[model samples]
Target: MSDPTATGPAVPPLDADVIVVGGGPVGATTALKLARGGMRVIVLEQREATGLEERATTFHPPTLEMLDDLGLAEPLIERGVRADSYQFRDAKLGKIVDLRFDILSGDTRFPFRLQCEQSVMTRMAIAALDEEPLAEYHPNSRVGTIRRIDGHVEVDVQSGPRRGTIRAAHLVGADGMRSTVREQLGIGFHGHTYPERFLVISTQVPLQEELPDIAYVNYIADPVDWHVLMRNPSGWRILFPAPPSWGSDEDVLAPDNVLRQFRRVLPDRDADAIDWVTLYEVHRKVADRLRDGSTYLVGDAAHVNNPMGGMGMNSGVHDGYLLAEILLRGHAGEEVDADLDRWAERRRAVALDFVGKETEGNWSALRDDDEQRRAAQRAAWEALGADDEARHEFLLTSSMLSSLRG
Candidate 1:
């Protein structure tokens, strides 16, 4: 609990209109947008500097559109692969249906997923932030405490070599799943963790070239173990489901065992050709509420989900847009409490109703041994491809344009 009256000795002045905790995609996006609107925004990132991350490689259509609007998408497009279609396949490598994004051309200017590493986007975001006179990104700054007083929020953080306090009219927590802000605020993140561990292996093997039947992104279903195979700038990534029974996370990352697992996808690729690999625990959770007074939660700070359909980071960036728009209106003297509340409510709704349900369904459809259920999954996927209207509708929804419109 923060003591409102206690500034504790001499305190630094309120530095900005808003203080954003976390400099990941969501926070960076939020700070960038707010700064663009002529608001003084300070972004606090715990990392000493931004580094390349192998995670969150897919940017859906709507997110790209938003970035384009901010003049940040063109460089991303130049650096990333444009995935025009996505597919689902059986264990034996038979296509179920190829959902083409081209069908969404009428609805969105960018009708494809941008397969760019999040590290690339983060660098671009920070660069854009550097250009904004109203914005300041303080790296190596982790939230110390957030207090509310005088109808305003004050954030204390350890930034680089200095500990300072910055006050603002509002604040945001976009740190991550294990957000310090969320924990200190005592928000309940309720959900279950999947029993299986997940691993993503980078490979030099040209999976797209070797497996001509597959699209750039392929979700292959199996009765027991499901996997996601996608193309990256490096080469390819095999997202595998590893149970603890297989071994510890370290054992799963062991080169020989990992190569053996790749046999399930690539029977001919040599072991030594492997690039690198990593593993993580998987969970599905949403905060009990995204808002606590004048502060808000967005991105992984608000929710965490399995990367089944590549929805986690996409939805978080969406939260940035949602929050930034409402806050901008409020700064203009508009009554935006309703809009801010709507942002929190609608984003939470999106986490459960869209990201959660869809991703859970994705895993269920892949590993369910029941033949009838498998057939239904295939049917639904094919329906997304074969029918023109249905295909357009599917892309619109899956690409998250519908989520925004909602």
Candidate 2:
């Protein structure tokens, strides 16, 4: 599965045209796209073959189109819940503003959000790579050390008995927050952690059927109980701030408390309806640089943001797409490193100025309890709800398209 379009003088012979560490959605997408372009790619992942870790449910329009271009949109759409609209509301279900994807209909073929587990996209990407002979996927290959050599980069991967070193003209660090590539390259990942720990619980009670007022995606504001509730193929997922009374990590995730939280929403529901429960902390961050010589960072390794608007995964996939396009041009006799620098600068700015600020603002809008602040926020939301032009502009930023504007 060599890159059919990879022409011109080539990179020196090596293990691959690019070596990607982290076979999650971002890494896999980068590998698949590069391989399709006729370049050799190898994806190294620390987890087992194929990811089924249920997380990240919202896929924006641009991301859906990219998946379609790669032949995955139909399968994903068939398995996902199409959410044409989402809302901003109070904790008690009083809607403040409702945004319709129809505003973006002219900008994209799919003018809606898809609510499916991140695992769906990961598995599909892996299946696509399996058919690509030029792409190799190695699971349980935890990256150890990273070294930048004369004209290439060296990555040491450790697995059961296959512990060895891999050398490639370029390395992509989609490995995640504490990325080995970023650390060895001496890049700083500066960010702050939210004080309120987050908790996610699933239920089979059919959120939309029971709560007719709610959309497939809903964001509720509450000074003490800010939360997000959404419906997907998996079921109904409710993510909210953990209580201050939580004594220990184990205490908050206990089955009793988890059930208590769900029962609070629907006291009549039985145990069968409650499914999965998880708790984690949220962060907002960006790397010092996206590229350091022959090595480049994408996805979580490069940036992170709160899950308030489901921007993390979407932005990461966008990172992969932008980087792959730049690398493809570099192989065609363009200024390689210079192009990477440009990509890094632009993407990093998006992560900081666009994604970071947007997510933070979303959280602030929901969790702000001050009387004056809440009123001002409500006025803004009302304006967005009433004016078509303003709503369209806001949606552009919310959907991550404004980041591409000149």
Per lDDT, the best of the predicted structures is 1
Tens-digit lDDT track for model 2 on 1-406? 6688999865545788899999989999989988887778989999877655557999988888888878888999999999988998887648888899899988888888899998889889989999998899888889899887778988888883336888898999999887888898999999898777788888877777777888899988878767889988978898878855776779988878877777766777766777878888888889999988878899999999988888888889989987888888777767767777888998999899988999899998999989799888888988998999999998988887676776
Model 1 CA lDDT for position 117: 85
Question: Ten-residue segment with the worst summed lDDT in candidate 2?
Answer: 46-55
Task: List, residue by residue over 239-355, the lDDT tens digit for candidate 1.
Answer: 988987887877888878898888777888778777777788899999998988789999999999999888999999999877998899889899988888888899999999999
Q: Candidate 2 — which residues are off by over 4 angstroms? A: 1-13, 160-162
TM-score (C-alpha) between model 2 and the true structure = 0.94
- Listed in order, each prediction's TM-score against the native is 0.94, 0.94
What are the Cα lDDT values of the candidates?
0.86, 0.85
- On a 0 to 100 scale, what is the lDDT of residue 109 in model 1? 91
Candidate number with greatest TM-score:
1
